[model samples]
Target: MAALLEYLPLILFFAVYKFVDIYWATGVLIVTSSIQLGYHHFAHGKIATRHWIFFAIALVLGGLTILFQDEQFIKWKATVIYAVLAVSLIISRYIFKKNLVEKALIGVLKSANEKGDTDAPLNIELPKHICEQLNLMWVAILAFIAGLNIYIAYNFSLDFWVNFKVFGLMGITFVAILITMAKIYKYLPEDQS
Candidate 1:
């Protein structure tokens, strides 16, 4: 159910585009994106920066698409969002010297004992080098996705581009997640795995 909700906006946008048109699809995308963010805030208590960024880009670009009656604006949203994310990750790593991937995975710190010094429960401690590598991998994937989106949006037909946005991009993200999991599998404690 959570997974479905996570993707509800994209799924709805695709379905609406099939039934109506790009304009309607863009409107639905904005509304559904907002709903998704609200759902996240309600369920998780706070919205993540990436989620906020995604919604802001969707709203601005989608609004322009609707107001100007140009699907091109909406089409560019995906590319811009992906590019911004990739750049953000690169800056976070290179400029800030913070590995966002590592920061994301190291959820709430908990001392497993009375000493308040042990972190045994979260045994999945990935090495710093591994985290840096994973961060680089994510940045590379985002950059590739961003470039591909622009290429398809320009070269392909409208319907094909919409389909690519809804399915192709989502499929890429799923595959990336799977690959990342496989990459990190060796880092997990044997007893937990």
Candidate 2:
């Protein structure tokens, strides 16, 4: 549900492109992204940082595409967003001495604890090496995605690029998540009694 909502703009863009054209599709992307953001804020009481970033990117790049009557801006949007995220994650890990993945995992554990899940594997702190490795993994993944987007956009037809953006990227991301979970599974705390 949330995953589908996150991809609503891209899905709408692809569908609109089929019915109309790139410019009109870009317009629909911007509108749908805005609506998705609004819905998140309304439901969650506060928008997540990533949601805000994506919404801003969609609006700005989509608007540029529509304004200039060029699809290039929209085509580069994914690469730009991924690059920004990769850089931000790297900086957060190195400069700020924070691992975003670890923080998020800890938050989930805390939430579970609060919900009275007594058996939850609540680590007081994620191991530093694990945090660093996970952060680097994410950086590598995002960089790969950014490069992949550029490669596809430049080498493939617009139709192929649109399909890749909607389906290929999502499939890649899902696989990456599964791999990450498998790698970290051993690190999770085991019940002791």
Q: Put down candidate 2 lDDT per residue, 1-193, tens digits, no spaces.
A: 8778877888888999999999999999888888988898898998888888888888898888988898999999999998998999889888998888888767865775666647655566557887778788889999999999999999999999998998988888889788777766676666411
Q: Give the TM-score of candidate 1.
A: 0.88
Deviation of model 1 at 152, angstroms? 0.3
Give the runs in model 1 whose Cα sits over 4 Å from its true position. Answer: 108-120
Return the TM-score for candidate 2, rounded to 2 decimals.
0.87
Q: Which digits, one per residue and each the tens of the lDDT, describe model 1 over residues 45-134? A: 999888888899999999999999999999899899889988988998889988887777554222223234444566567888878888
Question: Residue-pair clashes per candidate, as listed?
Answer: 0, 0
At residue 164, give the lDDT of candidate 2.
Answer: 91
Q: 129 in model 1: Cα distance from truth in Å?
A: 1.9
Alpha-carbon lDDT, every model: 0.84, 0.84
Clashing pairs in 2: none
